[model samples]
Target: MKILVAAAAGMSTSLMVRKMEEYMTANGLVGVVDAVSVAEAKERIRECDVVLVAPQVRFELAGLHQIAEPLRIPVGGIPAPIFAGMKGEEAVRLAQDLIAQAAEPTS
Candidate 1:
């Protein structure tokens, strides 16, 4: 699975991506986690399994959804607490859940 994280410009976003990558490696999951500015997310969305928007860029969620929904790609916003705390595990779980839900068949 490939996870794309969209955030405002900062080094913290890079750190968060590293944490998520470490979590995936420790858990034996084969995947790639990448961070990009919100402006770049729309272009890169097709390359990832799921898109996670940082708390600071939550306002762009709807715009992202416009692009992702049509492609059956899941897009969600990381909670303020989780993003602020840099809880990579929780963020990864959130991405996993979104992917799972997207794979489900409608009843």
Candidate 2:
């Protein structure tokens, strides 16, 4: 899964990206995760399987969904505590769960 991690300015998210990268490598999860600005996230939405927004920027979720829903990309907000703790494994699990939820048939 190609996951796009986004923050307001894209600067602070680098550490989170590194943690996620390390986690993915350690767990043998094959995927490219990119940390980007909200603007860049929108621009690159089409290329990612899932978009994970930083807790600080959770307000942007609605705007992101405007793009993601049409493209069928699963977009969700990272829990603030988990993100602050840099819990990459948990974050990835949350992302995967969002993808799975998106795949389910809605009644």
Instruction: Write model 2 residue lDDT over 1-107, tens digit each, in one string.
Output: 99999897555588888888899999999998898888899999999999999998899999999999988899999999988999998889988899999999989
Residue-level error in angstroms, candidate 2, position 96 = 0.6
lDDT of 1 by residue, 1-80 (tens): 99999988689899889889988999998999989988898999999999999988899999999999989999999998
Clashing pairs in 2: none
Worst 10 residues of 2 by lDDT: 8-17
Give the distance in Å from residue 89's predicted Cα in candidate 1 to where it truly belongs: 0.7
Model 1 TM-score, 2 decimals: 0.96
Cα TM-score per model: 0.96, 0.93
lDDT of 2 at 106: 87
Model 2's alpha-carbon lDDT is: 0.90
User: What stretches of model 1 exceed 4 Å from their correct place?
Assistant: none
